[model samples]
Target chain A: MKVVLHIWRQSRPSTSQDFGQDGKMVRYELDDVSADMSFLEMLDILNERLTAKGEEPVAFDHDCREGICGTCSLMINGRPHGPERGTTACQLHMRSFQDGSEIWIEPWRAKSFPVLRDLVVDRGAFDRVVQAGAFISVNTGAAVDANAMPVPKADADKAFDAATCIGCGACVAACKNASAMLFAGAKVSHFLHLPQGQAERDRRVLNLVETMDKEGFGNCTNQYECEAACPKEIPVRVIADMNREYNRARIKS
Target chain B: MNWMLDYWRSSIGGKVTMAITGLLLFGFLVGHLAGNLLLLSGPEAMNEYAAFLKSKGALLWVVRCGLLAVFVLHVITGIRLARENRNARPIAYARPDTIQASLASRSMVFTGLSTLVFVVYHLLHFTVGVTNPEHFTMETSAGGHNVYGMVTASFSVVGIALAYVAFQVVLFFHLAHGVQSLAHTLGLHHERFTPMIKTASVGVAALITGGNIFLVLSVLLGIVEVQS
Candidate 1:
C-alpha cells in the first residue's frame, strides 16, 4: 500500500537543530507494503529505500519486535502507536492504516528523554530512578520459601498487576504536562503490596518520587491520558495509591 | 489554617485539599452565578442582593474569609504538586513529544496561574474598590441607598467586561480538572461513576462560564438599568 509519511528528522541536538525548526516532513512513496508488517518494520523498509538512494536513513529505536521490550515507542498520527489501545509501535500492524492515509510519525516528546541520534532516546533516566531502590533490596541467602510469605491472593494479584509496568515511558509521552506519576506509581505500588517490600516501602516511594521530580517530569493532573496510552493499561488508580502511600511516608518521616 | 498543616504534609493532604477546595469553588460558582443573574432582573435586583450581604456584616466577613482560605489552600497545594511532579522527572527525553493530552489537562497550570491573577484583580476592582471607580457610586436599596449603581457602571466598561470573560474562560478550564480531580481525591471515582463525574464537571464549568458571561453582557448592553 502507498502512504504519505510525515517524519520528524533532526541531524543533531543543538539550539539550531530543534524539532519543527530543523525537522522537515519528508514524503515517501512505497508500493506493495504488507498490511501484516509491524509499524517499525514498515519504517525499516522506508529507511532501506533512503539508504539505496545514498540518503541518510531515518533513525528510530526498536528492539524485540514482540512488544515486550517497550522500546519501540512512537507517536503514530495523533494517538500513541496508532489508534489501537494497549499496544506499542512494534505491535501495531500496517492493517490499522488505510491504504492511502497520511501518517505522521514522531518520537516521544518529554524533557527527561532527549534525542540521541534520531529516534533513539536516553531512557537511562528511568533505570536510574529504578536503581534509586525501586526494589526491596533483600539479600540473597536461602531463597525464602514461597509458602512462608503467605501473601493473600487479592494482594498478590494487585501487586502483580502493578508489576506489569514495562517502563516504556509511554505515560510521560501521553501526558501533556509530562507527568511521570503513573510510571512512578506503578513502580512504587508494585513494591508496597507485599511483606518483603514493606521494609522499604516508605523509603522507596519517597526516593522514587524525589528522583522522578529531580528528573524533570511534569505533575499528574489526573487527566488519565497516561493510562489511555499505556500499552500495559496500568490504571491511574495506582497513582492514587502512590499518593496515599507518599502521604503516609511523609507523616512517618 | 494550622489544622490544614497536616493536609499539606502528604499527597493525601494535597489530594484532600484539592478536593475540598474544589468542591468549595464549585459551590462558589453556583452562588456567583445566582448573584450575577440578578443583573437580568435589573439593577435594583442585583444591588439588593449585594446590599443584603453587606447587611449581614460579621456573617459576610466570615464567609469571605472562608472562601479566601479555601482559595489559598487550593492554589498552594496545586503549586506544591506541580513542583513535586517537576522534580520526579528531571531529565529531558531525546525525542519526547506528546500527542495525547487534552487542552484542558495540558493548560491546567497555565490556566490556574492566570485565574489566580484574575481572582486578585477581580477582588481589587469590585470587592475592594481599588481599581474600579464606579464601585464608589451610590444607590438606594431596600434597606437604604448603596453601591448598586457602581457595579452596573463598572460592568459597562468594555475592557473590564472583556477581561472578566477571558478570566471566566480560564476558570472554566481550571474547573474542568478541579471537579474531576475532586472526585478522585475523595475516592468518589468508581467504574460506574467516573464518566458521570467527568461529564458533570464539564457541564458545571460550562454553566458557570455561561452564567457569568450573560450577566456581564446584560450589564454592558444596558439591558438592565440600575435603580437609583
Candidate 2:
C-alpha cells in the first residue's frame, strides 16, 4: 500500500511557537508499505527511510507498542488515536488505511501538553496530578489475606473500570476545552470505590482535583468527548462521581 | 468555613456553584411562571396575587436579595469557567469532528450571556418601568399597583413581544444543557438513567420557555384583556 503521511513537524517548545507559527505539516509518501504493519511500525518504516536519506527522523513517543504503557499517542486525522474506538494508536493497524490515502498525523493539541518535537508531547502534567494525592496511605505490613475485605461485586467492578485508565491524555486532546476531568475523575473514583482507599477519600478527591486545576486543565462541561475518545472506554460519569466526592469532602471538612 | 471558599475557587467548585445556583434559578423560573399564569384568570386574581406577594414586605426583600446573590453568583462562575475553558485550548484543532459534545453543550456560554442580557432588559422593561413608560403604568384599579395592566400592555407591543419570544428561545437552550449538566456536576447521574435525564431536561426547558412565550403571545393576540 502507498500512504502519504501529512505529519506535523515542530522543532521544540523552547524555540518554536505553541500557537502555530513554527509548526509545519511535512508530507512523506511511502510506497509498497505492508498493510499488516501497526501504525507505530509504519512510523518506524518512515523513520528508517528518513534516516537512510540522512534526514532527521520524525520523533514520536512509543514505549510499549502493545498499548499498555500508554506512550503511543497520536492524533491521526482529527481523532485522539484515529477513528477506531477502544484502541490506542499503536494498536491501530495500517490495514485501516486506504491505498494512496493522505493521513493527517499530529501530536496531542493542548496548551498543557506542549509539543516536544514532531508528534511527541510532554505529558508530565498528568504525573503531577497523580502525585497530588491519588493514592491511599496504607502502612507497609504483612500481606493481608486476599479475601479479607468483603467487597461488593458492583463496587469492585467499578473500581476495576476506573483503574483501567493508562494516563494517555487522549481525553484532554479530544476535549474542546482540553479538560483533564476524565483522568482526574478516574483516579478519584478508583480509590473512592475501594475499602483500602476509604481513610483519606475526601482528601484524595480534593487534592487531586485541586492539582488538576492548578496544572491548568479545563473543567468538565459534560461534553462526553473524554469518554468517547478514551481508549479504555471509561465513562464520563466518573467525573460526576468525582464531583460528588469533592462536594462531600468540602461539607465534611 | 474557609474550606467552602477554597473549594468554590477550584475548577470543580466553580461547576458545583453553577449547578447549585442554576437549580435555584430554575426554581425561581417555575415559580415566576406559575405566578404569571394567573394573568389568564383575569385582572382581579392577578392583581390580588401580586398584592399578596408585595404585602410580604421584609420577607419579599430578603427573598429578592437572596435571589439576586444566587443569580449573580451563577453568572460570575459561568463567565469564569467559560474563560478558563477557552484558555485551556490555546491551539485549536485543524480538524476536530466532535462526536460526543452536543451543539447545546458548546453554545451554553452564548445562550447564558443572551439570557443574562434579556434578564437585564426584562428588569428595565417591567420592574423598573423605564423601557416603555406609557405601557408601564402604576395607576390601574384593584387596591394593588396595576400589575396585570402593566404585564399585558408591555407584552402587547409587537417589537417587545418578538424580543421576549426570541429571548425565550435562548432560555430554552440555556435550561436544556444547564439542567442535564447539573446532574453530572452534582454527581446524580447513572448510566441507566442518562437518556431519561436528558429528555427530562429538554422537557423542563420547553415547558418554561413555551409557557412564558404562550403568555406573551396571548397578550399580543388579544386572547387576554388588559384591565383598565
lDDT of 2 at A212: 89
> Against the true two-chain complex, what DockQ does each candidate achieve?
0.27, 0.68
What RMSD does each model have against the real structure? Answer: 5.0, 2.4
Model 2 Cα displacement at A142 (Å)?
6.0
Worst 10 residues of 2 chain B by lDDT: B135-144
What residue runs in model 2 are displaced by over 4 Å at the alpha carbon?
A: A1-4, A14-21, A27-35, A97-102, A139-143, B142-144, B226-228
lDDT for each residue of candidate 1 in A1-253, tens digit (9 for 90 to 100)? 8788877777775221343235555667777689989888899999999999999998888878887888877877756666788998899999999998888876666667766655666677789889886887778889877798789998898788889888888887777667777888899879778888988888988888778766767666787888989998888878877877776777687
**Residue A128 lDDT (model 2):** 92
- The candidate scoring highest on DockQ is 2
Backbone clash tally for model 2? 0
Q: Model 1, residue A139: displacement in angstroms?
A: 3.8
Q: Over the true interface residues, superposed, what is the Cα RMSD of model 1?
A: 5.3
